[model samples]
Target: MRNHLVPVTAAALVAVSSFAFAATQHHATGSVKTYDSKAMTLSLDDGSTYTLPKSFKDPGLKTGEKVNVAWQQSGTMKMVDKVTIQK
Candidate 1:
């Protein structure tokens, strides 16, 4: 009886942990499509568009720049976290 109870508890814990892990939350990636001295427009690979704030996009990005961007709600909104320029 004790052995059976322990196994059940462990299984419950495992299931809860899996659920928690899935709720960690994450953002999608985006890329730089156009840039200028003040701002830039980023296009996500998921076919979404986002505008980078002037404070962040100032001096703009180059063409074909890949950036680490986070998206909200099916890639509607995006914010660039990191930019990696490709040759």
Candidate 2:
């Protein structure tokens, strides 16, 4: 039973680690369509929206601002790791 359990545990660990590695950061550039401070979300012109993590500082962004965003996806939720507003 212990032998069987070892493989199962190892497989589970590998699966979890693979999932973590797969959630690497990605970049997007677009004009902001909307920014909801209350909801902590920003929508881009390319139709991609990101949820800002609470730990992330406000970039003083506004609707229609062009931006470059670094984000990560965990399941269905998209979280912004960093954002840069374009001039």
Candidate 3:
């Protein structure tokens, strides 16, 4: 019985961890509506806002420029992992 229980617990933990990893990354593409340098946030024309990581450097992001953002949701905020400016 103990041997069976151990396998079941390990399987359950693996399943739960898989779900966490699956939901950890997300992506978005849109034109920039606003960028607040002080707040370290970027707003898209679609109304979704993302919090840029502190280490993020200004990539000459401009208003109305199309951008692709790779990010993760942290609490009530979207934390950016990378930002790519579109041509």
Best by lDDT: 3
lDDT of each: 0.56, 0.89, 0.93
* Model 1, total clashes: 0
Order of models, best lDDT first: 3, 2, 1
User: In terms of TM-score, how similar is model 2 to the real structure?
Assistant: 0.73
The weakest ten consecutive residues by lDDT in model 3 span 18-27
The residue-by-residue lDDT of candidate 2 on 1-87, one tens digit each, is 988999999999999999889879999999999988889998999898899988777778888888999999877988899999888
Give the poorly placed runs of model 1, Cα more than 4 Å off: 1-26, 36-40, 57-60, 71-87
* Candidate 3: regions farther than 4 A off: 1-12, 15-19
What lDDT does candidate 1 reach at residue 57?
38
**Candidate 3 lDDT, tens digit per residue, 24-83?**
889999999999888999999999999998898989999999999999987899999999
Q: Backbone collision count in every prediction?
A: 0, 0, 0
TM-score for each model: 0.36, 0.73, 0.80
* lDDT tens per residue, model 1, 16-42: 998777444345545665554444556
